[model samples]
Target chain A: MIRKGMIILVLVTLMAPCVFAQRVHIDIQAQSFKKFKIAMPAYTGQSDLAASLWSSCAKALRVSGVFDVLDPRGYITTAALAEIAPGTLKDWSLIGADYVVTGAASSSAGNVSMTFQVIDLSTSRKILNAQYTTQQGSAYRAVHAFVDALLESSLGIEPLFKTKIVAIREEEGRKQLYVCWPDGTGGQTIRGGGNLVLNPAWSPDGKKIAFVSYWRNNPDLYLLDVASNKVRLISGLQGINSAPSFDQTGNHIACTLSIDGRPELYLIDLATSGRVRLTDSWATDTSPSLCPGGNDLVFCSSRAGSPQIYHMEFSSKKVRRLTFEGGYNTEPACSPKGGLIAFTHLASDRQFHIALIRTDGSSMRVLPGSGRGDESPTFSPDGRLVAFASFDGDLYVSDLMGVAPVKITEGGGFQEPSWSNVMK
Target chain B: MKIGYRGFVVVLVVSVMFLVTGCAKKAVAPPEVEVTPPVVETPKVTTEMDMAEMVDPEVEARRILDQEMAEFENRDISFEFDKFNLTPEARKILAEKASFLNANPGVNILIEGHCDERGTREYNLALGDRRANSAKDYLVFLGIRPDRISTISYGKERPLDPASNEEAWAKNRRANFVILNK
Candidate 1:
């Protein structure tokens, strides 16, 4: 992560004309500024694949919340639609673009090649360029790779491209476990789903999903191996065994169990099946989310009279209240980056909204464009975007840029969406 | 005797299914006589006289147990929204359940605590836990063995009403009883 006040200057230069025909190459520096406006025109290519890749790239840039992506309709022109050139730099800058990225895609059969360049409008010189050869219709993978590399190298941040979210889609009492990309593509229902699956939490390795199911007529925590459809019951104690969270090691889970006659937080070791009690409150303690570091857990508790988020440290067993403004704040999801915690807050309007606060319980605010009845806020693997179930029961992903949360999923009744780690 | 009766029922159902399929196939294609080969399996089924001889007291015992268990399950105790404490009416219901449980020895029950859709899924699960176990505690106090009763909270995932209205929500927040065999 970049320091809040630091600055980075990104530099890019073009390769020779012949080499640029098939592939673009240039140098790059780090970038620290926010909201750098960039104009991207349709890449020069004849295939429909090129058009699809362009739209995918444009949406990715906008969703990153790092760039003010200029509206393509504003940049549409007779010549701009046909081809991209260095001569178009003036047109992009005239539209108040501080930077411009242009590309060309050509594909036949199984192979597709994409050549792209990023230019700094102030210098009127190309600052970065690259090329990729990939399977047709998956040129977006190259774009994702580029964005991942660009963010890591330039901003010290992880990109959220091509990530998958697993959520339970329920209709007419049949709940099927659904997994899809952030853009609603490549969706497939995971096997071994039951009629009552809730609260999916991804393992750090992205290879497993821990969720609650009632296959045995009890709400027990179950771990599902993504590669194989095999499932193993992680916890089946009496009463409720829900809200499973994998610690950083993936060998332990922090969950809620009521075996002691009331709901309390418990840590179950995956290896020994041993358990450790974490909370001793008389009130119900649930929705435990392990921080990225695994030392702290943010969970919703009724210890303070109503549902509120609490932060607990394992070493000292110290507990502190996190949310005081809302009487119905719950379902806390600690970010992967370990700085912020996202949770559902019942606003004064009686609508549940997704809100974020620092780990210390400061700077609490509802996320912009958060819908009513929003619950189960899960962060992207990179901590850049948040995927949550909206009021209408569709999965929505937003970058917190004040843009309305885009519905990345179509099916209704998506509940407790758990985002997998960036696809390995 | 139970095994023989169940076997007879299975064979009877399978033969009926075969007859139905055979007739459908004949209607679809009269020339395909090979499709009606179920005639060979028809003789394997036992006559009604063999079934009449297999009847035993165990079958009547099971029927009575099932009816009594259904009544036990149908006697669901309700709670106020977001609250799990037993009320006067709920306590009266539980007192009657305690007698039934005392009379039926060797029978175990599972108490499922549920919530309405008005609350979030995870928190309601915890609430449901308290709701179900609260009933279990009272039963244990009323002289029922703790080992005879188990509890599970379905939270808001399983709803009795499945509606967004208050009446449905009221019907949903209750502790339901399920019979389990030893």
Candidate 2:
């Protein structure tokens, strides 16, 4: 008999790569790692809609990078899938499946119901069971919800299925804002009334976006309310009113403005027209990203004669430099999941790469997937992946270790990608 | 030897006669050119003497004014990479621009700050603002009204040259002038 303290280091989720009882940790950044094999057959009572729902679930599992969804053709056919008997589970074990996900869909009066279960092949037991009913044509919603339930319950990190990413697409000499799912699907173009739209930053609730546009022939900051589809001018100062980011409360925005002379960081109160000057120097300060807490923020500055990332604490007004190794670094993005800052680092190849450092200014490491002009690194809300734009202007999302970056956007002219927080 | 020297003298006399006649024909052609541009047998190459010497004083003044206006707009002030301080060449251009603006008070100008595509987009925007405003401030200090000049920073968006080499980058980092109001 054994008892344990609740230090909660990690949970041994049932997902494993092979037939043996393999312990799976949730960190995809681990150097020595193998994907757990998950078998997802077509949903029973399948229609076109059911097939799509099952496909979305499978795609989410694959995008998570934690599972190797086995080919459906390799699944056993003409066999009894009724019970978790040793004989039946032996067939799955032999097929290299660690777990089998079975689901069913039924349509009623304008509603679709889905029931799914995750069965452990190695232990011969059912691990998760869930039932959901959504509007008939809205079964896609259930797909993400089910995947979220599956992962959040077992792995403690919800897979990125429902999250969205926003980027700037230059079309015919005009730059417009666009939004799509994190998988680079569902591209919806947004014309925010400008010849050039850029620096899109999503609010914490995911309902509001703060961006800068050249609509009035000047770089002015504006807020786009996703629900109303309306834009409100937040700052239209004399010089530049750009690089806006929201505090945690979503009530104020921190941005760079050159109203006086040089570029300096300023915070604007949304409710009131009141303003607070955060930084005052001859040096240029821009691209302020607030920490997960509203108290501290990091930004880019040229105080050292070249652009470098700096950390600023609001309470003490104490500022420290975050990057020292690189002569050029800018566009610091504070991780929403906490304690990490991602920015663009110019490497020896003279190409820009995404580098991550702890908020304490330690353990700075450059990521892989370095392209010629990789910039604007935004952390996924789950904090596991970062989506950045490359020299070709396509957005790519890679994990923290920067392995196997999936090209999320295509055909260039798409860049300055800002990953939205997971939709409510 | 006598025959060769005599032949040389004859050739020189014939060439001098042709040159004199040609000079007389060209000298007589200016009035006709004032009426309509004369079609010379050779390709037209206009030197400063062509405009200043042949044209009347009023027309010459208009031409000079036009040249100054074009120079005001065409002569862009460039900056060092990642720095916004005005170079001596930039200051010289701004001084000349001030002289032009003062002479033509009815004209207003817009200064557009641009940068090379080397740094992050947002930082470049800030750098561009500094470049544009620095040019504007210098012009203002040179006795130009602040309201007469408006500045905008295109950041790395509008490049005078889009190539990604040293030459293109040097051309791109500039503060360009546009005559906004005439």
Candidate 3:
């Protein structure tokens, strides 16, 4: 067995160089004060694949969270570009373009050849170039791959263009839940459109949805059967039930209930309808997240006299406080790998932002500025990103609401985003 | 002066009518009050006959609730800050209550789970369940059948005391017994 493993390792080590060469390259300055601006001219072809490619290159670059794409229509006249190339670069430079993307598409046997080039506008030199063949609808995938390579050449970090988002979509005045691919494809709804729902949570299996719904006329935690479309009330027996989470066991749920008339943490046994209370404070205890081991749970508690996250162990029933630095913290969500806990942290100004703290509660760092009320944050499956719902207005826009999240979903009004676990 | 006199006459007539009727009804109703008092007392006696009904069913419920609340007020379940397990003292109290339940099978008790208002709402709920179940399991082991006892975890919803303190939290993190449906 050791010999076989050695042989496989040897082959893998030998082939690693070739794999690295094929990977996309991203290039950003190690130190730069200004952002990179890129210009994209429409791909030329008569086929639908060409049109898809033309739209995708711009979309991919825009979604990269980098690169301000110069508007061709704003610069070059449509009538002029339709008849003549008109030297599109001249107009782009007049508006201060640092990089340019030029592409041409051709179709044969139902596959498209999307050849694209990245040029450094400053040096007037070609930075990188590539061509790909892909099916019609998936032409965007090819374009994004090329853009990824271009981004690597311009920026040091990789772009999250391919990552997807999970959101609660409001449909026809009712709240429904949905998961959309990064490019907004494969939209699937987790809850029915007509039900009143809040805070949908995804279990590690990625198959079940744990959310608060008024299906029973009062707030109750319901576990939705993703495939069978069946819904069962999980931990609900009077007084303000909400916020359910799953431990590694998958059979039990960690939820908040107000049976005692104040919100607190409770564990529910799926088999026997038994419940156990975990905290006994006169403050609110909510947002329960089970760590990777299934035995330890991290939750937000006002026990410290303010809302903060705390870690609890099952065997010893020992509780240690987790968050101490923040004035107020709530809605704790543990990452899939159990490294970080994402939560909503309130600033001294009463502004809310998504913050990440070490599981040990040592390094509590808030993500760089977002609009006010950036509450209900959750982690992506890979633990690479966090999604939260927030208002776009300045910190003072208490009057303005109902704006959709920046770029995660097509339809707006998403709050309490719970990233789904890895899908099989 | 003429209007005032007319009003005075109306008042005199109303007062006389009320006095006559009141006296006549009082004179005739001694038997009904005599007969009704014992009859009403009998049903109230039955409702209060059971230990669970020691007070007015609703009033008794409120009173029993108030009386049992002293247990939570007096006892404190200590957790580090966010934990759900019972400590040695907590177990000792649970064991004592379990013994009480074992001594009396006729009493049906609800083990109310509680939390110290400190954590996230959902996690505290699971913690509350663990705390309540920890007590329930102890009772079952003490010879109380699981069927005889039903565990209901209230999570962090209910508080024995409204004060937000270590004192209040220690009080809230408890498994309380009440004659719920019994």
What's the TM-score of each model vs. the native? 0.79, 0.78, 0.52
Model 3: per-residue Cα lDDT at residue A278: 84
- For candidate 1, list the clashing residue pairs, or say none: A12-A126, A12-A127, A12-A128, A13-A127
lDDT tens string, model 3, B28-143?
A: 84544434444454434443356653555787666775555455335544454556556788778767666656655666766667787554334555466556666767777778
- Mark the 10 consecutive residues where model 3 chain B has the least summed lDDT: B39-48
Best by TM-score: 1
- In model 1 chain A, the worst 10-residue window by lDDT is A1-10
Task: Give the interface RMSD of candidate 1.
Answer: 1.0
User: Which lDDT values do the candidates have, in the order given?
Assistant: 0.78, 0.82, 0.63
Please report the candidate that would top lDDT against the real structure: 2
Instruction: Report how far residue B82 has shifted in candidate 3, in Å.
Output: 20
The DockQ of each candidate is 0.53, 0.63, 0.09
Cα misplacement distance, residue A335 of candidate 1 (Å): 2.5
TM-score of chain B of 1: 0.66
Worst 10-residue stretch by lDDT in candidate 2 chain A? A1-10
lDDT of 1 by residue, A1-424 (tens): 1111111111222123221121222221112334668887777887477678877777666666566678878884524343346676688889988867777877777767777777678777665566666665455666665555445433455556546778888777677677766666555666455777888888888778898888887888898877666789998876778889998889999999888889899999999999999999989899999998778899999887899999999999999999999789999999887888989888877788888888999988787555557878888877767888876688888764435677776657777788878655
Candidates in descending DockQ order: 2, 1, 3
Q: If you assessed candidate 1 against the hidden native complex, which CAPRI class would it receive?
A: medium
Greater lDDT among 1 and 2 belongs to 2
